[model samples]
Target chain A: MASPMSITALASDTIINAGAVDYLILAVYFVFVLGIGVMASRGVSDSVDFFLSGRSLPAWVTGLAFISANLGAVEIMGMSANGAEYGLPSVHYFWIGAIPAMLFLGVVMMPFYYGSKVRSVPEFMKRRFGTGAHLVNAISFAVAQLLIAGINLYLLGSIVHALLGWPLWVALIVAAAIVLSYITLGGLKAAIYNEVLQFFVIVAALTPLTIIGLRKVGGWGGLTDKITSAAVKNGTSAGDQLNSWPGNDISGFSSDLLSVVGIVFGLGFVLSFGYWTTNFVEVQRAMASDSIASGRKTPVIGAFPKMFIPFITIVPGMIAAVSVSEIIEVKAGGSVPGGSSGKGVAYNDALLYLMRDVLPNGLLGLAIAGLLAAFMAGMAANISAFNTVVSYDLVQEYLVKDRDDSFYLLVGRIATVAATVIAIFTASLAGNFSNIMDYLQTLFGFFNAPLFATFILGMFWKRMTATAGWVGLVAGTGSAILVWALTSFGNPWTLPGQGSAFLAASVAFVVDILLSIVVSLMTAPKTSAELNGLVYSETPREDLVDANEASHPWYQRTIPLAGIALVIVVILNILF
Target chain B: MSVNTTQKQHTAGILDIRNVIGALLGIYGVILTLMGLFGDTETDKTDGINANLWAGLIMLAVGIFFVAWVRVKPVVVPEDLDTGGDDPAYMEKH
Candidate 1:
């Protein structure tokens, strides 16, 4: 084990010699990503192609891109930080939270969206609810997208600053500029292609790191002993509190059996269902699939690979905790330093400390690159999505109408630039917050969660009125803000319970849904023809031909394969 | 429009089962790996290795079940009314 200061010094020394090589590798990576964008631009002859990759992407490509987009820099840092702080409990985000949600969205919600043939989630909102609902959805989504972009930039800057002694703004600007250049030139195509490259680079780097880290700490037995010893000294045990099962501590289940049930049924189901079904970022990926069947399977296919992320991302943190515990104990007189009440090491800093001390030089460079890939993938996705929605949903809808293909393409480029600048500025302004990942999630939850609720209701319930969508959108968002403000008062709102603010916003959303239904019943029901148009577009006769073709039996074959995955998950849970 | 509704219904049912099984197998792989990495040796390293054994057995069974199910289940034609394109095969004959 090494002291924090000593570890930092070692990391700095190793990185200094490799600075030129690091920069060269990164430059080449940047140019490669940019080249993909340039090639992708060639396909951008129409608004549809620019926004949706000409809707010809294969199922696997869409699935891969979808997962890659969600795999942002913040997620990597956040997951690593979580692994460091909570041991295995961080797996909840992927397993109990993200995977099931993705599957549900693909199977249930995708059919509706693809069947309707809408370009953007907001456009679908207009059809399902009305103009006012569309406006609200667009505004809220834009805010969330901007915040996500800013957070990614901020994290990228922080990591560079921590590792290389570079100024935060300098790192932020460089990352943003590189990502923005590709996104501006190529739109979703560039983002997808670059994301694919990033996905490979990140996996290649992190997989070996996890293995080496475990070996460094002398295998599983040695790792456990170290952690158990550390935990006993710290007055705790590594159990469900550390592991992310259904009854995990972070799910707010503390000795009350009823609370655990409520968390599983209410929070777990609702949050996962809401995100998978309604999130624009996730939905955008599904929308890019070549066909409805492919769209449905894309998420399911994506989930197979995604299930293993905790191994690569979370395990390293646990290894780090075991390795670093001895140093922290010595430094703080048997107490961990910088954690909540000196119980553990600071979660975000834990992995970095481990990397600095444990990893050799060349391996260290690879790890850094892996982390950078995570950041780039995340940032690039945000910038691309932000530019697309702004250009297609807002600019095309409100500012300009009846535009030519080239005109729309130009608008996309301008939106990309504007979005990049805004994100960079916001990143610079956000001062150092404890656990940068949590700060970003909190900001996103404030804006996006309520919007997600509204979209879910709008899509599923036919009785949901435009008036209800507006009321819910405004009231839900407003309540979240008010709660956030009130919680911040008297103190800086650092308390863990402050996250309950999302609950208030969620309540407002439910109320809005109920009100909308009552209002719609009292008022006139939309005509059947109008409702049909809103829900289902004319199924192109050509699609019927392909649907009838027998060329691709593999698509049909994957159905049962997906079933095997589910049974295996349940059996594992019972057995493990 | 003349496609067998009953067959489509059966296909949907099989698809649902397939999806569940696939998710289970995928999740099982993850859990098995985690347990192997994080299992407490002191409690059940030698005497009560049933937990580890059960995990492995369950994973194998579920995986086998999924493979067997996929092998046995009849393939149904995908309803592809969404792959709209200029591809000649997809073109409607007048």
Candidate 2:
């Protein structure tokens, strides 16, 4: 008879041999990361250095760190899980949603933000809109950050606990403490350096695991044959049915034609334009670069490598799907496993299951480390970002009217520790939710999608008023909540799928914009000088070669490349 | 001072064009690659035959366009840093 703790220990040992060796390695890595944070703190003589690394991070560091910041535990686990469940279609999220947004940020929005020389995104909002709108956006964003931080922490805790037989709360506290120590000491600079390290570790771990897994299944040829056979056994054809295009019958989860179109045109545009353009977390990285050129070019440079992530994350899952048939047939008399049952294997758990069953000894530790790196990288960035927002936007803006550099730095560190604790608590509680990805998307949609639309309208449209900004924000969020509620009640509100919620939110934004326009037109126009000043305040004159000029070449190159890439992707998609 | 201002404006315009072109190309390339790799066929298979061919052609066209744009709008070298006489860090070494 297996005792409870012994069973847990046995399960963990089976996965990673989490004896003294694994613990020692993880401990050393944690110490090294904390040491870097302490080293980075030497330059923190003032608030500017503490908050933004004195805006002196190089292009490569910014680029690598920015990519790493986005590459968190949620993505690592989520993508692998999605790969197990959805096949190749999950790749679309990266290709369609993330890459374009990064490109847009590098070219179009970076100049405006970096040029304005604003320390925070909310500061820019206050300048563009007004006090009320700025406060609302800032508060909403801080809350969103808390949620993201919680999710990342929860995933990290679960993975660590599963692999090491540690208590879940102990794992959560350890992860949070490790992340908070660095973020509390060095702010964004420490986070970026840590992220770069994490990125390399993560890729190194995942790459070989993928190769060996493929080899175990008799290489790509054998894997393809197995997938085809399994598809037939599951009563689906080998072709379009397997592809996750719109109008497919593989349940709502499939990335069929309608969902694809919606994601590509609607969710893709909104996510890229909104999240990258206006979101403080993303922009904060850009703002901390050594120069405007570094700020803009880093994201562009980052996109080249980021394009390959799906290959790393999604391909392995597709490979796993081929073997799942055998596992399922033997265990449950069907082509799916009972462990996952109807609700589907918890997304990240699928990746863990693969690592435990397939890999040898040392390699398993590396993969686990990679996942930990992803979680740490994400947690550091989010905590750093949250601290910056709370300290700069909320605390300093509302409470402290005048403060010395030392005061602000001290406050920033305190805020970071507070934010990490909240995130850890939230992560422990969030495990009860069934589908983490859907939950994250729905929550993100309610706030971010509409926020993106309003920002675009505000920046480009000279007539957009503060009242309109407020109304649009409320209406978009309200409509998304309503739609989410209706769908939960089994309404089956399918224009294209669950993604319709995003579309509905966007429509609400448009309606708000029109109403804002009507209201603004009835009122007098603000002077041209005021409008021009807002637009061109940070914009450098044409003649001088400002730091912003250095990034121009990369941005210029990426635009046409993106277009050509899109055309090729579409053509290949159509033919092959 | 007046001459310096005129030079700065010209450089800014040239840089702006370069940034815009780079961004567009970057976005185009990523989207095309994704569509090629995971593009849905009429039959719902992973047949990326058409997507591969098209992506190649599109890349060639865009590559040519970027080359031409760079040739036509070369960046003008500036005489001094444009730091508005603020940060000494921006001042060029003599």
Candidate 3:
């Protein structure tokens, strides 16, 4: 069933050939999503309502949106493809990489963020590092959002064109209009609600496919049995398909990239911490909850569902490796672990093939709709974050200070439209990257690795000066670029893409911490009064043990709940 | 998850939008699912499987649950805090 055309064309052809029911499913999703936007728009009176959802979200809604916002269609597609290629090891991204960091965000950092009451993540930078560092963070963040959003739009348009055979531009325009309409009108609250709905849609869509696929493969034992047989038949090591710990031998993953050390230290610590803790894209939802306690619990609540996602996404990919015959086999070479030497699927078309080959028409339509919703949710989240940072941190705080609240609100709306348009234009340029997940992870390393360092020191150590923050950020980014160049330009010593990113991020983080410490020791520290509520030790926003909270059972507390999550993750790693 | 009892009687905050969207999608999902299952003209697009029926039921369950949640726990605004429109808590000074 694979198309004999270009990689992009094959995906479009698959979607274009989908049944009519799929189209109807998509149409309903579009109408309902737009309706939510219109409804959300009715109460917007100022910037706060638009940007922060009026600080009225409950923990459940915020939690779902927080994870859904990160659960972009690209993530689904990329991770699934990784599953097909790498097998069981890919599950590590979920179990080990994501859960711990999310819990850390909620249990440790939320007090500082919610207590200080900064509007945007970069605004937090301004509070901790002063104007110069804030500008660096705000400007970098704005650029990153645009790039990521543009990538999402490009992917959505490509998927629609692949599935429906419509012109890519038509799909792009329609998607852009729908996202812009709802996001511009409803703002963050509308975006949050829609994301929660999208999460349900995605679960509903993929779960059936996983069940059906599992049944066909004869359950877990059957799946492993078939993949192992295929790998052996194809002149590949079955170990590659079965093992989570890529072994020490040359036949396993290249030593630089697929080691447990790389995954644990580089990904679990530096990369995951940087992306989850500091990046505004995910943090904005947490900051929007009704109370500090609820706000703090957002990410911890999100981590539960996050742990289960690999079952729906990665499992299907593993099934595809053995079940989908059209997966184009490639000649084994560097970094390409031995898999069936038959045909290999387009690295990105794994999920599209699953829907096309596995799902029936009616269910396929719903699945397509869910995936569509996922795409929109991802775009909307980015656009909302972009608008918030641009309008508040960049414009309202610096350029147009003292503008009436209504004026800033209008500016936010305008910025939303402008950012969407810019993303539309940039989407056309997004076809260069081959693997979306790897590319994004690399990008995170580039900017956020150093930023996370700054956040860690700034929040915990009062002696960390503003100049130190700026210097560390610059040095960190510079180090990341240097490491990336060494790897990409074929310096014989560097690791694979993930390894390079892992090493660079680790290097940048260490550099940032050391540089900041040295610089802070030499520079004048901000006074105790100025540092109040900003640093960890001197903050007044610390809530003394709430009598109400204390009275509740220990299981209900955030720490205990997080403890439960940690235990569950540990058990899953051992089992899987 | 307890609803705030201090809210005004008729504030828009009473209606949780999650319920509304959930209910709408769920209802439509059920209709399409039924059409796939009961309608004689249903095509064997999913290898003779009733995919529509299953998907619709899922949506129906999701919709019913959201609607039920809203009915069970209507969100209310806190009486003590401003609705947060143009309020100082929301607005930041340079």
Candidate 4:
């Protein structure tokens, strides 16, 4: 988000003038956030206890945490913004882009992560492909977390700036310190516990806003009618705004068939799979569960909540598009003269303006607190993941090998502080963007897509060599960057939504697979013994599962749960 | 029993996620309900109903349900149990 950083105003105008009750409610929420950290700290006696919660959390706890960890600024604000701009095609992000890949992670990929027992994703890479690939993965993963965390931190500061009429630097420092205290005090346990609490708070805040917004428009019928007419004014049809399928407007393809292909192949398969399966922010929650079964069920349990998230997130954005005057003005090729950013009205302002328009004093405070919790959850996920990669993968592996458990635990705490401080600097780098989803999608293309290509191919194909791993990742990332460079920056081609991002990811995935095959053919592969638990064909079935697996109920099992979720998602798609 | 003191049961359930969620929602519920009754309801801001009161009552009900759930099924934290190390031999031995 900060790449083309040229704007100076962190925030010029305040969006929410929170009253005393709003402040009290927000205060209570913070106390609980800190309290969770304190309680979680009681459980931490060793490095494992700090880094992985000693893998002590139950499936349900981890499952909720898994989803909560993701209910951050990106999912809430970014999706709402998408909904405001793209309309119903935005649900494609939740349904087509996320659910299948999440299920795939639970049923197919999680066993390897749990069975192999790596603290981080980069550590998993090291066990499979050796030093070359592990080093590349660890560095890139660490860098990516820092950059994303900055985005979350900046948004959090913006929320604070909106609440009180505080300066951006003061708000940034205060918000960073609050997050830093919790992560450093209790490590991953604190972060996960806070995330679970934050999730419920987020739901409680947004559900009313959505229902009230719908009420303001009369009902769902009224909302659809209003937005439908508004779409005509905006020069797009009702189908373009309301329907999710064959979305030519979303995929940046002039033709409907090409748009569907671009959406299904690019966003759904490569980018979604890359983020869910390989990204350690999500994977860490699953890894913290007590057993392999619990770990596997983590994502499966989350899929239930995840599939319905767009209702609260994107629906409110759609509501704002019709109801909020500033949002409407921006939609019809105009800008708010004195918008919050001091630039103009952006799609990101949809939720905030809608809150102002509909919510009264008490509920307004709850909504503001909910937004704060979300931004904190997002930042905590990034910082926690960063510290893990730093202490366990980078520090232990290369810099300070053969350290005592206590020493490494200390290193984790220090890394948490370092990340928060660094994020404060990078937080300023992100200028006001019209829609943040474009930047996020582009980042995922550059990082996660290539990494997913490497992991998926290497895990299935026993013939893939160690050298091919690093070569494929580097080449794939470079290609995605090149593709993005050619398309953006005053280029001839213009993508409607996140088409360039999708194109970059698809190109990266194809390039990585092809290059891995070529490189693996030239290089000698690792022996079957070395690839045992890492590769699917070489490992026995028993090595990848809970040995006492049959005792649990059907709901507790991964296969049955994922199957049920997939069916429900299919029904949702048809109904919508 | 001494080892399980970190997860002390009879005291305030601060560590438990359900309790935290329930208690937080419960407090907000009470506040909003009180506000609905005594303070400004702002019926015009919402449709015609007292939104704070209705939403507050609903939140209170859900919060109490969670508290009752914790009572029905207390989460037992396994203390000082031997953790399964990453060694393949330990897994194979089982």
Q: Which candidate achieves the best lDDT against the true structure?
A: 4
Models ranked on DockQ: 4, 3, 1, 2
DockQ of 4: 0.30
Q: Each model: TM-score of chain B?
A: 0.42, 0.39, 0.60, 0.70
lDDT per residue for candidate 2 within A1-576, as digits (tens), equals 000000011123323454343454455457657866776665355677667766765566677777788888677766765665556656556666677787777766676677666788887777777777788888988887887788777767766766776777898898899888887777777787777767765765566557656766777677667667766777665554246455233224355565556666565676456666777777788787756656776677676667677667766776666654433343223443222222234334556666655543333444676788788888778778877778888888899968876788888888888889898877755765536534664666567767877777766677777677777777777776666566555465554333555465556556656666776677554455555424543233541124345445543344554565455445534532
The reply for model 2, stretches above 4 Å from the true place, is A1-14, A19-21, A240-244, A247-257, A324-347, A432-441, A490-497, A532-576, B1-94
Q: lDDT of each prediction vs. the true structure? A: 0.60, 0.61, 0.75, 0.82
Candidate 4 off by > 4 Å = A1-11, A431-441, A490-494, B1-13, B81-94
Which lDDT value does model 2 have at A193?
73
* Cand. 3 TM to true fold: 0.90
| Residue A156 lDDT, candidate 3, scale 0-100 | 82
Error in Å for residue A398 of model 1: 1.9
TM-score per prediction, in order, is: 0.76, 0.77, 0.90, 0.94
| DockQ, all models | 0.03, 0.03, 0.28, 0.30
Which 10-residue span in candidate 3 chain A carries the lowest summed lDDT?
A1-10
Q: TM-score winner among the candidates?
A: 4
Task: Count clashing residue pairs per candidate.
Answer: 25, 64, 18, 0
Better of 1 and 4 by DockQ: 4
Residue-wise C-alpha lDDT for candidate 4, range A508-552, written one tens digit per residue? 999999999999999999999988888999889998888656666
Interface RMSD of each: 13.3, 14.2, 5.0, 6.0
The docking category that best describes candidate 3 is acceptable
* Models ranked on lDDT: 4, 3, 2, 1
